[model samples]
Structure formats: structure tokens, C-alpha cells
Target: MEYRPYKPVNLTAAGRDYAVAMVRRHRLLETFLVTTLGYSWDQVHDEADRLEHAASQTLIERIDALLGHPDRDPHGDPIPTVEGHTHRPAHAIRLADAAPDIYRIARVSDADPARLNRFSGHGLRPGQTVRVGEREAGELTISLPGNDQAPLVLAPEETKAIWVSPAASAGLRGPASI
Candidate 1:
């Protein structure tokens, strides 16, 4: 049997834009899943990723409205604007490098399933305050509010996936009623 290399699809500018728009929709849907539907942090990413490409713009808009125009997704990723504009925060650090103080989770990488799964187990969600307790080698031990008994330890790879801002970190200390 002759072997043939699979050729990847070439995406034009329009196609790229469509792809970004679809990603934006999926991120928004993931936010809804975590905030409204009560889906686990680890469970929503794949579901939203699949749905984002399939859902219509009208349906996405409705979901966005239902989610109350959220700015960030479940994993702290930015939700793309309806106009496709994305406003990202300036400072983002790995949980390992983060100082031992309250800080807000800004963004998280969506490429790694294992990392996301680990974060979910630690209760590390966007808009949640994380305090870095200690760093040993490339691993970080951090604590979340209301979870002081066991500090969550994360590797550098896992920490790099999470972005955060100090100013917004203050918000995580308050009630979750937002």
C-alpha cells in the first residue's frame, strides 16, 4: 500500500476570521456552562469547543445574553466581542510565579486537556482569587479562598496556562454572588 500524507486545509483571511469568531463563540458558551448551567470546569471545554463551531450566530447571541454579557470564560479566557474585538488584560503570570497574595485569574490556555483537568480539581476558576503559598522548583503551592486546608500544587506548565491581574485579584475575595 502506498502512503499518502494528509494535506491540511488552507484557510483564507475570511476563513481565519470565521475560525476566530467560532472560537469566540465557544469560549462564551463555556462561560455559560460554568456560570449558568453549573457544569464542571473540566467538562465544559470540549463540549463548548464542539458546539462553538456548530451553533448559529443568532444562537450564540442568545446564549451570550443569557450569560449576562460575561467577559471571561470558565478557564479565565477572554470572550470575543460580538464585533470580534477582544480586550485582554496586560499582566498574566503562572500560578508558580505568582506571589503569595490574593490575585485574580485572567486567562487560561485551552490547548491542553490534562492541564485543564488538573485546574478543575484544584477549584481554580477565572475570577477566583488564588494565593501562592510556596514554590518548589517549578511547582507552586497555592490556596484559594474558602479552601485553606489543602493547598493546590501546580506545575510550571499548568501555571503558564493561567493568566491573571493583581487589580482584579481583589474582586475574587468578595462573595460569589456576582
Candidate 2:
């Protein structure tokens, strides 16, 4: 696609392409940050967001190869395909409505840094199994895979942002499992 600036003349087609490419890189980088580098889910977005626009295609490819071609980022957002296409599955669910038990957190909205931090503090991460213990009007109390005490509570907004997969019996692990 020919690059065209979205609004202000300060933007150029090259700049637009760069921006799109950066966004793509950022999502892929998030996957690497959490899975390979041991970065907390909350810690990767800002750094990746900054680097995405600046990184070379070569660099991004290297990271992608290292991460084994992850399809989703740390927040469960889709990573853009190399050709710039994004394939996102529609599986979002509210934490408040989820049954009280173990399930896999598939994705979360990364728009709020503070919310992401709160999720990480409570041990919520993509692919990790979590047990919902209680549900209030606007919040869900959850237990991490290995933790005994429940320290994670998702507010209505946060709960709405999180996407989960139904937990299979084989995937249940109590606190200390992760």
C-alpha cells in the first residue's frame, strides 16, 4: 500500500508505513518480553511501543524467529503477520461473568498501563491458569496457579478487557504451579 499521512502534513507515507510496522513489531516484542525474557506482562508494552517504530525489519525478524513466531503478544493481542495482516480470534469474556474456577487468560486490553500492572501484580498473564474464587457486582477475586491467597481482583472494566479460555481438567494447577 502506498503510504499516506493520516492527518497532519507532518505525517508522510513512509512515516505511516513506519508506524504500522512499529505497531506490528511492538506486539511481537511483547510476546518475547514475557515468555523469553521473564519480563512482567505490565513491563513490556511501553518499552516495545517505543522500540517498534525504530526497529529495523531485520531486527524484528530476528526477534520473531527467537520467539518461535508467536501469534499473539503478552496482552493476548494479535501480532501482525509479516505481510501486515492481523488475525485475531473472538474469544473475549468478562472476568466477572466467568465461573469460579480455573481458566486460561488468553488476552487483555493493554490501553491502560496501570491496569496491566495490577494484573501482573496479581499473577495474571497470558497462558497462565487462574482460579476465580468470587464474583462481586463489578469485580472478580482470583487465585493464581501457585498462590494460596487471592490477591487478584478485576474491576468491571478490567474484567471486560480480559479474554479467557475454558480450563480443561488436565490444566488445573494449584498455587505454586507456575
Candidate 3:
């Protein structure tokens, strides 16, 4: 147990290993809570935080297996592999900055449960499709694919927490997004 100042970039080998293991446990717990226990994405972050430090490695592994080894957590954050590696998407951009075109909801932040609720109320989720409408007066409008639903309006800050990527034309032809 060494008392060293925190240096995120230049960690010692042992420090880095411990850091990675902790992060892996936290993420796996989040995935498991969401997938197996039906916890919403916004609810898992705090729950994982409380359990990660106390849960044993064996319990974490069992949970991972139960969830079929999910690669992403409920909010679409990558879960570190058993080897501590993470893969990030290359083209994800904030919905606020996305061009006025069709985009698929890639990820939403878990930092704000209220915002997550708002997104859920509008049927926004990862892999769901949305059309980027106009941005005006610090708000962004997005059209959801439904005959009866109106467009969803979000604040700029809320829009920034959402990531989207260009949806494939063929994928958009499905009944949900077409």
C-alpha cells in the first residue's frame, strides 16, 4: 500500500493493473444489473459504484456469464475485456453537432437520470433511429419514426450527451425507423 499522488497517465505497473481490474468489475456489474436484473441504464451506474469495491472477482465473472458476456453496458459504454481492453466507436458524434440527416442513437449518458428518462419517454435507445431535424434557439429537434408521435425537442446540453452515427439506408427501411 503506497501513498502516491494520483497520476492518471503515468501509473506504475501494479497501479495500472489494479485500476483496470476495478474498472472491469464496475462495468461488468453495470452490464449485469441492466441485462439480467432489468435495471435501467441510469440506475446501474450508482448501483455498480456501490457494489464494485465489495464484490468478489468470482461473483463478477458469474454475472458476466449470466449476461452472455456483453460488450457494452446499458448506456452503451464499453465494458473492459477480461484483459482490460476496450473498443471505442470511431464515428460517434454528439447529436447536437450532427448534420441535418438521419442518424442512429449510438449512446446516451448515464450521468443524468432525468435526461435518460426524457430520452426513454421518446423511445430513444441505442440502435433506435432518429432524423436530425433543425437546431434553433439552443434546442435540437429530432424526428422519431412513428405515424402518431411528434418530434422530440431537447436542449443543447441534453443533445450533447447523446451520441449518434449515420444510419445505413437499408437499416432505416425497417418498419420502426422507416
User: Per-candidate RMSD vs. true structure?
Assistant: 5.8, 5.5, 3.2
Put down candidate 3 lDDT per residue, 20-118, tens digits, no spaces: 888889889888887778898778888999999999889989988888888777787788888888876677888988878788787888889888888
Q: Runs in model 2 with CA error above 4 Å?
A: 1-20, 33-39, 85-90, 97-101, 168-178
lDDT preference between candidates 1 and 3, better one: 3
Comparing 2 with 3 on lDDT, the higher-scoring candidate is 3
Which predicted model would earn the best TM-score?
A: 3
lDDT of 1 by residue, 70-160 (tens): 7777767777787777777777766556776667777777777777777777776667677666778878887777775687777777777
Give the per-residue Cα lDDT of candidate 1 at 62: 91
| TM agreement with the true structure for every prediction | 0.73, 0.68, 0.86
The deviation in Å at residue 115 for candidate 3 is 1.1
Arrange candidates, best TM-score first: 3, 1, 2
- Please give me the total number of clashing residue pairs in predicted model 2: 6
lDDT of each: 0.73, 0.73, 0.81
Q: Which stretches of candidate 1 lie over 4 Å from their true place?
A: 1-13, 112-114, 167-178
Clashing pairs in model 1?
104-169
lDDT of 2 by residue, 14-95 (tens): 7766666777788887777778889877788887877877778798899999988878887877777777777654554656
Per-residue lDDT for 103 in model 2? 77
Q: What does the lDDT read for residue 145 in candidate 2?
A: 55
Give the range where candidate 1 is weakest over 10 consecutive residues by summed lDDT.
Answer: 169-178
